[model samples]
Target chain A: MTGNTAPSQADARRTVISVDAMGGDAGPAVVVAGIAKSASKNPDIGFLLHGPAEELEPLVARRKTLKGRVEIRDARDVVTMEDKPSQVMRNGKGTSMWSALESVRSGEADGVVSCGNTGALMALSMLRLRKLPGVNRPAIAILWPSRNPQGFNVMLDVGADVRADAEDLLQYALMGTSYIRNSMDLPCPRVGLLNVGTEEHKGRAELKEAYALISQNAEKANFEFVGFVEGSDIPGDIADVIVTDGFTGNVAIKTGEGTASLLRSAIREAFEYSILSRLAALLAYTSLSRLAKRIDPRRVNGGVFLGLNGTVVKSHGGADATGVSAAVKLAFLLAEQGFAEKLAARVASAVELAQDDATSADADAPGDSETGSTN
Target chain B: MTGNTAPSQADARRTVISVDAMGGDAGPAVVVAGIAKSASKNPDIGFLLHGPAEELEPLVARRKTLKGRVEIRDARDVVTMEDKPSQVMRNGKGTSMWSALESVRSGEADGVVSCGNTGALMALSMLRLRKLPGVNRPAIAILWPSRNPQGFNVMLDVGADVRADAEDLLQYALMGTSYIRNSMDLPCPRVGLLNVGTEEHKGRAELKEAYALISQNAEKANFEFVGFVEGSDIPGDIADVIVTDGFTGNVAIKTGEGTASLLRSAIREAFEYSILSRLAALLAYTSLSRLAKRIDPRRVNGGVFLGLNGTVVKSHGGADATGVSAAVKLAFLLAEQGFAEKLAARVASAVELAQDDATSADADAPGDSETGSTN
Candidate 1:
């Protein structure tokens, strides 16, 4: 086992990140702010903002003091968050988001990050970029907001493959584990299966089968397989990675965001209604703000689409300047660290752990079980 | 349209509610306590317990002088929460919970309640009682604790059918609306499809069709069909009834429950171990307690399986007497208000609204698009 390898990975950084310029309500403004901040701080980094050159001129003009690390590429249309992805994929060749993804696929950009239409990005990336060998349907791995000292946990298949079979779930666990250990650099990163209960026998039939396969996998033995974790555990880092169906993961994370939002609004709305309450709220402002910041979504900006052939990071459609900045940094870090190859290797190693169970005829022949040696 | 028949739909049982004697943890004890509390002030209401002779004897002996129109029935064996649903239906011939359901089915009991296995009650109820004519799948509906004076906004299909198409979602929306409109007695319950975003085209293809169908079904307009709602809106009562796939719904509710548990632990752990922090905790006790109560899962017991042929309420697996009592009230309300029949008509009327869209062909679909549903 290659136990330690960070120096060699960090040295690889002719890395260029492609940002979707026309994405988000804030438009190129926030994306520009984020890219400007990233480029100003990191001398070695470079970025290609893909969108209309005319529109980009005004945004880039404001950042005149920016160093030579920035450039712009023009493209025609923009994919709104509300566009039908199926139709978009067929006809949106002119979209800058599409062009940005093309740059990554063609090896012009090391990675692509977008703050607009997550559904469109995932569909286009998987279609144009394709899935890695031994990877099934590419899952959208999103990092949850966290206040814990351990930081964010990557929740997989947030929307990539919604209705997952047992094998699909197992693959998610494998890929998620690799992403955490390789990209996040956690030692023997802990893996937790999200479930309604902690009991091994709990949950659906598919979940039960997946649990057995993951639990019994000898390759997974190196990592701390922490068993079942409930929803809130995702934020708490009870495990470094939480595996779930895309539907649930999406709902849970959005729910967390919504809950935090509602709480903040409730407090604000409460204070807004009365003078006495406003005075009390003023007194409580410091602690409330501290608590709000503790659960703030912006600090953790992007969620990586793991198991894809190349790196793709998706920022929340509603992300602001700070959030977009964090996403850019995340993309850079992933590129510099060469987490893809490392994660792929680690995940490939994990597949070997289930060989005993795989000896049973049907197991070895299905899905992404085709070996790298098959080549 | 029966546009103004709300008052006649009010529950018939103006006084006490009869509960399943052998339901939930601390069956008689907690039920006895709940009965005591609910009945203490009302005085006119009563609680009827149904269970095995021996179990009721101890509770009957212990309560001594407790009131609320307490009554008992003889039964045997418990339908455990962990039992396979098939076993509960086929083999639990003599179980107390089953017998209680039979009572409700027979109209001998005003309602039946059990904290035993959810899948079991749902299956058995359908097996024995079947569904309301237009209802293909039964939905489990419960109130999520809310901040508003209304207490909770109803969330349907907590875990009824693990896989459901858009038709099922429509059914949930319609049935849940009827419960809110006729039973819970809300005026024009706003229906929202639970999803990842509020954008028009933000979900799987199945949901897109469901959204279109919901929008197109403008005739009967069972309730004002609000467009997509995300997870964050659930606690905020963004709509009176929120609908989604049971799989995601179940996961979301469990996530919320698990989150509340984790937060409680976090609050305790954060404050415990030191003197000044302990003092701070004491100062914040009331506010913290209010938060705890607001998120308490147990306070609202049983999730009703709406659209079933007959009324069946699934109590939380870990429910105590309090939960059991709540389940009883839910069941009683359903029975007293003729909830199922009203729901059946509402569903039939809703089907009429979407007659051209086709409910039968698209029922219980698992994110499959051909039939038009995937959440």
Candidate 2:
């Protein structure tokens, strides 16, 4: 019903992100270390580390390096990997995950960054924050593993919706496009509907129709709908925002991640084979790191929930200290820019334009009184 | 209408596959060489070469190597990358692209394999060969780049459907599962729908619903639905057959291919960095190749157009001799196993199970339908 309340610069002293202190394999210590490091570098940025006070209290940095830049927001429960979404929502009440999001909702903090259960986060966000206007659904878009200079393309609904029609796609395109433009700061980003082929008739019947609507309406006049893009096309600097159902989106992103890992392992295996290969590995270490950095998803660890009323950054649950640091930093940017409201406004305008056309069509067919259908 | 045609092994003659004799960077000479090698290895195999009579004419191997195994099917046209799919289809009367697929559809040959224009092949095949029974759409399933002994995952709708919905997803699962069983000889392999997350409510609404339906039906039944698989899951032997809409599938495959190339280039750059690294490269070359072999999609180039009336393999348009050769070899295996007809029967059975439910839903007070509606 409402957009994220823009924090007044004068009223707010610092940008604070609620981080799940217990998240990641290395646990709260790594998270606190990352926060302390990030806070030390950016004096204006602060953090509310959420988790068991016992572990995090001792782990919290007490140095002038991060002086006046951090605080611990204690929570009793820890939402582990095996926890259900509903349990995270209902039972994990004063838990780090819930408190973090609530902090944002109550305007205690600028945003919430989590590396905990994704399903729990989505469920909680929907319940606490709620989707924005005209957003029948919210999509969690992350940077797809790619070769684009803009880093990686942002793909949404990675695993959000399973059964969606044309409307959801149109919304995702507009929302993703807006987020990239306002948050990621791209110019006239190309938006492509992920499909099997470039052909108009390819994909499911719904996709064919979605393609026609995207093409015909000239939706998001600011963004270019670069027609349909295939799986292979994703690596190219073709589309800034590639839209698809969450099923495909999730698979595509993971595929890239998997390949990167596979390549890394292969290179490692090659290096371990013999003394010569071992020598090459040592000699080529710098070059390999360079390549890894260029393709690293961790550098940009946070994925903003586009089309939502406020900012929520979903960091990798398997993230290290480096990833957690990046996620906190990204949240600062989104909140500072008031990106959510900007995206919501842009998305609202597009939906309105689309709705106008639909209303006129209904007006034209007043006599039939037929149900508005996709057939 | 028919179960697997029973591998025609009962008959004396082997199923023939007409390959693009003039296709690929290596040209007909390579095709001639590869065919000779295959025929010599498998005495039952036969080759139908399509190209200009002159180009297909003279060869040293023609007499000594492929003397009786190879047969030239004369055609005047060679479809280059520059040629449009429409142009290739229009000139099918004499072009290598058309003749390749037509030769199989006409029953002049058992099936067709082409390394030429993918768009041309897909267009011509759809135009010439009908989809198998109960197949609402035909999709291509490609192996995602992966390493390790289990091989990689099979992604459906690689270049088939651009957009997809619930029904399309169900069909892809059926066809992909059938492909694994009949062709690859994996009985009831794990089937996974690619998405952002594995939760019942993750990904797009369409995908979530699809996940629900699949997990309910495919979980403990004919196929194992492994809940949800992420993009990274494809390379780690999580599931044998991975299903997703075409958009994500295509992007995932391409991203894997491009990232692999990028990594490969980076590895080369690492080698050229210094004398020591060069030595390492030399020492590590064998191990690297072994790893590359595990991740090479080219080795698995042949992707069957599942749910098609006849067996057809669409090789990558940019494939070289080795890639095309792989596709040809795969097509041969499918033909030998009568994969297409058997897959069709499995798909038909699944559809039959859903028919009564589908009929009731459609026949009841119809909801607004978008069978062909666009956004």
Candidate 3:
């Protein structure tokens, strides 16, 4: 395991991230160019690029920045977006995505990064790396640009699975809190359960049950529980970690993205409507660029797979060079901090203790009302 | 009942809508001013203003346009935002919201419009107006400004209930299609079931079952079934009618609104960052305003409660005069066209047929696995 061979502080300064250099909407050229940008700026980072060597070699050779830091791994197949997850899982032995994950599994790379199909990537990761002990479900956590002091908030379970029971939601909170604490360096993150309304009586029965579980564990887990938060609070300052089932989180994120896209196109069309508006766009270019950078989804393009034995970052499918580079940077940060091992340890300890508590109560009641079972 | 009192085409030309002049965050002044604006523009519309006579009489007197078009109904109570739904339902006899709904109940007005507590309004609506026969649950339908040829798409069940079984979702699709057909004049609206992913196998068990139900009913119901759609399609052109349970719909809309607000504030701060940017803002004001008006939430302020015996439009709780006027205008249009009666009949006939199918199937197979129950 990488945990045993992680090396001394001096050797740990350098980290390797496996890259799936195929299957993204923007093509391998963008992925190669993106890694080159990250490798040039961060000398401590190296890549294990997986794809057809013929296609990737030319792209790598064209970029002076990628000179000795990139290692291309030849793979025979590519996973398309239309490929079913079950099909990919069964026939993906020689695929680039399979090779990329294999590097992480063998400890040849500290983490894996892919801009391929999200479902296929997640299915492969779960199959190869396996879920952490005591974890019923793994979640996908993303950073949303927010008005918080950290400039971003972590939202979790964004389409890993469509459902989360009370126990699954509590586990999501634990994993999310550990993630923000390790990556963002917050000592005690404030976690909020996502619901239809902020009122205590609102939302589904499972949410209300999840709220009680999360609240009970917040103090012991070293995070503050803010009870239930509405969808609007996802981008607000009330909570640093927003926890919900995959269904709500997935729909909310996509809806937010769609709205942002709508506004961007509208603003662009407005600036192109007249000559005076064109001049105004020119003058406001710098400020506009700065504003765009702050809210750009590309800047925070990575969605980390939590509760897995290994770390994996999934970039946007249509991400360009800049977006891919952002995902690479995120993988580097998580790898440097040993996020995967730390998260597993955190979840294992917390969940084990929770199970012990449930067991003791179960011994007394003998399966009366506790229903102590993993979802 | 409005179904019995609905007038002839000539009499319907002069429609009367009851306006709840209290309970909104903006106070009765905004409501009175809003009705005045609508009454001045449409000579065929009249208002039944529900509030304190002293408070509304002077506001109505100042507007010569409302001289003969408005009638004041004195109400001694006001329902505050802090009031619970159950509390309001039991003790809200003399409240403006109660008075407004009562007018519709007694066939004194063709419809009702209120910028009040959504939960209270819905509770009062269901209590006083009742649900249409054979309708399992009522849904709140809203107009989402979109890229459709009609320039808007209808989304339903925005917060009427947090839970929906497969049958409820199918009912939402049926009701939404009928709404778009009658209001937007779309002969055969394309209905899409909202899911975590567009793939058939994605999302929860209920969504999968709902997909099959909606698909089976499409041909018979006279609407195009677009299989499944993701949250991004809410603002996209693939579906003219987006149907989901109230929880997902509510969260998606609020998340969209919150994101738009974030971008709005960010753009404002960008323009105010420097004098040069302020000059650019000045030059871009005309173009910016045009874009703003196009996507303004106020332009689509009302949420109509479908599957009800009478039509009721719920405006934003904090809406100003412009927003309230928009709601009033929507109420006027629906009342003029007897939308409430038409929608009730459509739902009753369609649902009766669906229930018959369920009963015959149940009789044949007993409990084989239909789960034909409302949520």
Candidate 4:
């Protein structure tokens, strides 16, 4: 494990994370620094760093903590922020991002982390890792800072695919619950369906259908169903996991981020407006820093790809060393818990239960008027 | 003008705003106080306050500014917050909310303001005053605190309808631009179509069509079209008007609000963390208050209903005196500017232009291959 000769089966305690060294806005130096930070904190972690060896070798050599724990995989190509998902899928095989995923694909690494183009990362992930059994759409789930006792709430389908049907949303719920149970150790998390209003007769036709479907499967799935939740509930204590289609979830999270960014700048501007305030800011520096740490986006930087055959964490493209380190930490935790296998098993059983429920309903009443209308 | 006897044509200087006094959660007293605040600020404003006369008479009698400027219109019933929009439309004729809208419908008032259930208010508004000619669905537009020089950016379809097609989004751009021009005094507002990404090929099918349609109509409509914008650009300086379907728009705004609220409370908690911080809070009071004033939701409480025959301002149901006053001020300003009629004319001409363009396109290329794919 210390030598990093690709952690053997005997050194199962060492969690090897394959990282795309060339994907981030910051260069491979930052990626090396991030892994070094993780290595310094956790002695059981190792890395398979991917990039052009000539460029990454110096960066890795500079980090003392990463000396014996890192193995560099040379790949000449790099995927930029401008690359499209379609283009990446067709021509990205030569890139470091592809090489990094290959390490996980071949079971050389427990998980993969990349601060690359989100679209490209998700596309390559789905193409290489494939979807789990009975899972139609794989979702990207992020932990939002919240008022909950856990300090965060899970939101899914942030931008994986813009559209999610009723069945797809139900699957997100199951996968989200499994992720939360494994990651946060919540055995029976409260799940809420994101909607315009909490009423029984609110939102789009698909949401109504999703409501009935998720509700019917809640008890069998071992989770409590909080029927409908508004956008405000994303950071609220009302639910542990909030589910929605990718488009709405993406917009909501971005809007929340933008608003928080705006307010933070405003707070700084206020403290700088007058001499009295400037003095006050100096006096309150320690308290303000604590508050900042609590809401810092860098602390919760990873977006976990759910329902995939292997675990892949997407770090923000513009992430710095701290952001990248947080993502690596998340990936390591998931990999250590064997999250991918557990999620796959959870979704497979849920699909079986759903088919059984449909069969029982058909046998009991062929013309069951209780079935949700497509409209 | 000062007496408010339902001002005649000769007394056109008086701008009468119909108020639904019974709809607010705080009751008619707060409504009276709110109108009094508006009356004290503007001399030419008047109100037709609708509620039970016995309950409203004493409240109006206590305010010197509202004495002669306010006229009470007795309506026996109130539209409760829990009532369904459908139920209110059928049995709300006797409610003060209906009477308030009737004043605008009969041209006795220039605009209407109500602190009631939003769905019921919108439903009764469409049923009473009807949609403007050539308008398909009416939208609710609200001003958001932003990085713009104007201090705010407009976002529409906040919750008026859960669905909006490509054509509906085009209308939102047209109407939103008009509202900004009349309210914010921006002659050529920059409009951006909200989507998951700024790229042309991103987002749902309707958004792509909307992007093309909005781009095509920009120059003719005298507004600068800034292609596609993400949710972050709603509060960003990149766009003055951000357009999207109601479901997405509603979720984005609420998420922003919730995030802001969470951060504000966190700020308060941070200041209360230590003795030094408590002293700093006292010293930074004025500066913090200034920042609070700039981002306070009460100052921008009203959500203006667009594309209607008459302007309707929906205040928060739980608005206090200050919140109600802000709504009243917005209604007064729009009423004085004759926003409804001007908007109707603008929309009418835009529809004609769209039709003419469609006809010309059909003639120019009988087998045009440039049409958007419905898939």
Q: What is the C-alpha RMSD of each candidate to the true structure, in Å?
A: 8.3, 9.3, 6.2, 5.4
User: Of models 1 and 3, which has the larger DockQ?
Assistant: 3
DockQ of 4: 0.65
TM-score of each: 0.80, 0.78, 0.91, 0.94
Error of 1 at B41 (Å): 3.3
Ranking of all predicted structures according to DockQ, beginning with the best and ending with the worst:
4, 3, 2, 1
Model number 2 iRMSD: 3.3
Worst 10 residues of 3 chain A by lDDT: A1-10
The candidate with the higher DockQ, 2 or 4, is: 4
TM-score of 3: 0.91
RMSD of 2: 9.3
For model 4, what is the error of residue A108's alpha carbon versus the real structure, in angstroms, after optimal superposition?
A: 0.8
For every candidate, what share of the true interface contacts is present?
0.27, 0.71, 0.63, 0.67
User: Which CAPRI tier for candidate 1?
Assistant: acceptable
How do all the candidates rank in terms of lDDT, highest first?
A: 4, 3, 2, 1
Model 3's number of clashes is 0
The total number of steric clashes, by the backbone 3 Å criterion, in model 4 comes to 0
Please, what are the lDDT tens digits per residue for candidate 2 over residues A1-375?
111222233226677776777746677777787787677677667776677766766666444555445566768887787688877777878778887888788877878888877778888888888888788878888766455676667777676655557878878877787677665557677888887567665567888887877776443345678888876666667888888876666666667678878888776775688876677566566666665676576787876777666789988888887888888888888888887777766666666666666667543344323212101
lDDT of 3 by residue, B1-375 (tens): 112122223254578899999989879989988888887788888778888888888888888877767778888799888788899999998898999999999988888999888888999999999988877889999998677889888998999988889989988998898788767778889999999888888888999999998998776677889989988888889999999999999988888888888888887898898888888788778877887887688888899999888989999998888899999989988887777877776676666666668667542344322322211
Give all candidates' CA lDDT scores: 0.68, 0.70, 0.85, 0.87
